[model samples]
Target: MYQFDKRIVMTLDAGGTNFVFSAIRSNEEIVEPITLPSNGNNLEKCLETMVTGFTAIKLKLPEAPVAISFAFPGPADYVNGIIGDLKNLPAFQGGVALGAFLRKHFGIPVFINNDGDLFAYGEALAGALPEVNRMLQEAGKNKVYKNLVGITLGTGFGGGVVRDGELFLGDNGAAAEVWVLRDKRQPVYGVEEGISIRAIKREYAQLSGDLRMLSPKDIFEIAEGKQAGNMVAARETFNHAGEVLGEAIASINAVVDGIVVIGGGIIAAYKYLIPAVMRELNGTLEMYEGTSVDRMEMKAFFLDDVADRDAFLVSTSRRIMVPGTTETIEYDSVKKMGVIMTRLGTSKAIAFGAYAFALNELDKC
Candidate 1:
């Protein structure tokens, strides 16, 4: 591990509504953060705001920052540090060469990445995955988890994958864009249509037959109230959201089987969402059981007893013939996978992720 105590980097969390600035040490210590309105509609003002925030932090530092890193939203080129036209921040139209701009202005290396991807890297390196690995090691399980999927549920559903201790950006840097996957109910709509804050409001409205504007927090409050009808509606909304999320996760698992770490504002209602997600995952395991069987088959031995080998293979196969349907199905063996709330919270996780990512990049030089 790099010596984090001796390294500090300037960090920015360029959120949809706010531009939060801070400095983070490799040790995961965060300096005071300043939050400012994004002013996202005006590109000039947005750039100026970022420069001003970094300048102020630079003035307070005993030594100049080693590098600058940002956790930014994206549909653009993360590898090149460019930001595409963002729905929330219209000023970023036509894609901005943000990394080059920042590097030129600050005279230091600058790195930028999608917020969801950075969050996943942070949690895997310093948060949930590490905690889980420690516990498993202490329990003498001889297993350590190094792969994880991170999901953020807020204005939209965001996803990132970390495999074998490295962030998986895919060939085109659009690897974990889970939101675009088809929805279960309406194939025309993507997974985000059923899992985002808007989805919650839409579901709640349909359930209650009331179309009044309501935030997810407002819906959660109603669920906690004594009104039976509203409570059921609210619960059902979250339950459906969880089911959608679980389905998306299972699909991702087919490609990369690992624990999932969930974060963002909506996760505050995890108590209501998790059970529903687990229920969906339990029901949908059959869809991915083939992958699990393949893994188990890799361990099967030719020397095993004839009956024992057959029975073991049959159990792993999980194949069942459908009654009167000329169809067969496979069920998963209830593989141990975890879905847990993030321990680092959102902001700190992003900050630490920025710091860690900068260090890794700088090391290459």
Candidate 2:
């Protein structure tokens, strides 16, 4: 939203094998990215690579960067920028003060955070949240939203919460770890077991007597009757993921009470997943007395559904008179939430998140 801000932030896209570094100004990349090997098994080389990458970007800029910010794999002390044991980057298994090293080297403020958190923050700052509000305004509605929950469904299930334009990083730096929740379909496994790439393949394979694994893309195509695979089995696989994802999101919504935006590769098949998600959200829970209660207090609407999007944008407020006075005030009592796929690509969202976060924090100082 603050695309006119003049401050520059150095950012990187850290991956398992490489570090792609660049500088962001006005919420956009200002230069071509510089790449370097991550050398994840060797701490010394990995650290050096990060420094080199940032330094190269720094030299190309005519202006000094005000801060350094980027996302890394988590299980980290993000507040202090210390990385914990990472399965992909084994050299950090013993913990490393990555943020501190960068600050000392560059003599600028350094901020590090989980990718999920940054992704949510980015969307909250510039993507889905604002777009929805703009829609409401254009529709001449008074309803406005101030919170969002963003999730990524790719290699694993991941999420972040943003409220009132602030990313919610909970105590112990482990907030929004949705993947660890118990799977409803498999009590012995985490929810991630039923919501990831592998989940689609595993479920599709198990559905057929031949028991062959297939990529999620190919399976989705099969479900569209465009490829040579079991169509029913492929559709069921996505439904399975949707059921578990819905459970996790509904539980999260109880606390967040906001809009939900989903990203990652799997969301491309939202058509198949969202119906199952809606079923679980609108489903009921049983009481000891055999009464069925709505699954969530706030009804979750899939925004891709044209009718649902219209409902979400409609104003539910009206003027009400006080019981014992002549005074009246406008009030709204609708409790609802909307979920949709991310319009902004995940990587761009993360980069914008880093850029916005750094500028915000710098302003505080």
Candidate 3:
């Protein structure tokens, strides 16, 4: 997804080793990136590296950047650009004012956010949210969505929320920490135990009666019947993971209603994952009084399925006339939500997210 606004924004893909710096305009990279060692163990060196890299990017850009925006691993006060103690970067042990320093150095606005929040923002602005709306419009629906929940499945389950074009960072800047949800299969363990890369390997090992520590990709190939392992075990592994992921999403929807979009390396195996997810989401909840309620008020549909998409796009809204007046209004009775995989790859989504976020904030100023 590309931004049409021509304003320039400098961005970084902050990593433990190489700190990548580039400038973006119209939601696309405009200059070759400069990479420098992060020196994450040394704050002085880390700060210097960022300054150097951003300076180089600025020199190569066609014009001055309007702001600086990027993602960093966080236990942060993102509203103020103060990073808290991080496990990956020891130099950020204290509340370091990363954003304030960048603003001072570049003499422009600086905004820093975590990847999860930005991922959802990116999708809400230009990716899954827009695509879903377009599909609904094509199907002759008048309902337009303005909220989204984006999740990533890989090393750890992560999530973020976007409501009406704004990234919904909570009061403490820790919203949508879905990995910490209780596992559906093992209540004692975090949900990530059932939904992540390690979860796939561990489950496949136990199911196939093999302990060779096969990679997740290998297990996926096995499930595809292209590798020499138990196809049943591999498919079962992903199914269990999807169940846990769906449980987490159901819980999230209770608080924030939105279309859900999934991404990350683990999504390569989504063929085996999403069906279980829909089952779990559409499953019922039982009350102490012995009554059963739908887990979600709206039915969850996987957008990739032609039948599901058709069902989701079928709206049951009606025009109602007022009793006391000539006024009439439209009312929607059918409830539904769509879930889909990312359209933009994860990295590009994050990059464009940063670029778009910077411009949006600037416009508000």
- Highest-scoring model, TM-score: 2
Relative to the true structure, candidate 3 reaches a TM of 0.92
- Structure candidate 3, residue pairs in collision: none
lDDT by residue (107-166, candidate 1, tens digit) is 999988887888888888888788666655654555566798888889888888999878
Q: Per-prediction RMSD in angstroms?
A: 9.2, 1.7, 2.4
The residue ranges of model 3 lying beyond 4 angstroms of the native Cα positions read: 317-331
Q: Provide the TM-score for each candidate, comma-separated.
A: 0.84, 0.95, 0.92
Where is model 1 more than 4 Å wrong at Cα? 1-3, 226-229, 284-335
Candidate 1 has its poorest 10 consecutive residues by lDDT at 295-304
Give the lDDT ranking, best first. Answer: 3, 2, 1
Give lDDT: candidate 3, residue 220.
95
Count of clashing pairs, candidate 1: 0
Angstrom error of the Cα, residue 293, model 2: value is 1.4
Model 3 lDDT, residue 33, Cα? 84
47 Cα displacement, candidate 3 (Å): 2.3
